[model samples]
Target chain A: NAGVTQTPKFRVLKTGQSMTLLCAQDMNHEYMYWYRQDPGMGLRLIHYSVGEGTTAKGEVPDGYNVSRLKKQNFLLGLESAAPSQTSVYFCASRRWREDTDTQYFGPGTRLTVL
Target chain B: LAKTTQPISMDSYEGQEVNITCSHNNIATNDYITWYQQFPSQGPRFIIQGYKTKVTNEVASLFIPADRKSSTLSLPRVSLSDTAVYYCLVGDPRITGGGNKLTFGTGTQLKVEL
Candidate 1:
């Protein structure tokens, strides 16, 4: 199985431009998350979804929006890209179970905003 | 949410064993400790996870003391391919109060040389 996959492996955006990053999972996981990793720093949570039609803010939710319109898809949007928004974005999914805490991650999408 | 502390970087040679430690002073009773490894330009992959005592897997081992205040990720017989960033995460996904959030601190960068 593909597990989790992200669209647009890489992207470059200018200031004020907008874009969306797509995350999809084939494992029928109930939870999905979006995180950004900056150089020399750890990943910070951006947004997450517990199930279809449910979304929540994370530690670093500013400058981003998320939607979980479908059970297998979670989308992250940048209304106005900024230089600070440039980072490697990762998407992850996990089956919501007490016994299974492992989260499956996507390869990642490298974004550069200038 | 519990915050994790880890080394910024570590250096090792091939065939030597490596251990990375992480501290989480405020870890809750339901919290679990998990580790992830990331290669350059790639997403973080699961390594090992534990709550207390020790847990061993094919790739690594996790050791948590009875207090659960800290954890150690041990990698045996390191190779150049093992060079990457290792992150220690502490949290519980089953708790709805936190929305299953995960906090990732600046992970330890392990560099292995031949």
Candidate 2:
């Protein structure tokens, strides 16, 4: 299985431009998440989904939006890209369990907003 | 969501055992410790996890102290492929207020040299 796959391995955007990053998981997981990583900074959650058609705000949800229209897919969109949003974005999914939060992550998409 | 602290970097020789420790002094009662490995330009992957004492899997071993204030990830017979950043995370399993969402630390970079 392709565990998790993210589209646009690399992207460059001008400030205020809009873009979307797609994440797909083959594990049929119930939870999907979006996170961003910057140099010397830990990955922070931007948004997440509990299941298809359900989305929630994470720790760092500013300037980002997400949708889980399909069970196997989650989408992250940047309505107005900012320089602060230039970072590596990762997608992850996991089985729903009250005591288990083991997540499987995607390859990651590197985005640069100038 | 408790904060996690880990080493910045570590070096080891191939075939040697490598241990990366993480500290979470303010961990919650319902929190679990999880470790993830990330190669350059790739997303992080789950390595191991434990709630107490010891937990072993084919890939690695997770050791948690009785206090649960800190945890360690031990890699047996390290190889060049095992060289990567290791992140320790502590999170609540219940989907309450984004605590279940992962909060990554600036991982410890483990380098296995010949």
- lDDT values of the candidates? 0.92, 0.90
Q: What is the DockQ of each candidate?
A: 0.72, 0.68
lDDT of 2 at A27: 93
Interface RMSD of 1: 1.4
Q: For residues B59-113, what per-residue lDDT tens digits would candidate 1 score against the true structure? A: 9999999999999999999999999999999988678656678888889999999
State the TM-score for model 1: 0.96
Evaluate candidate 2 by giving its C-alpha RMSD to the native, one decimal: 1.7
Angstrom error of the Cα, residue A76, model 1: value is 0.7
Q: List runs of model 2 lying over 4 Å from the truth.
A: A97-99, B96-99
The lDDT of model 2 is 0.90
Q: Per-residue lDDT of A1-114 in model 2, one digit per residue for the tens?
A: 989999989999999999999999999888899999999777989999888899999889989999999999999999999999999999999865655578888999999999
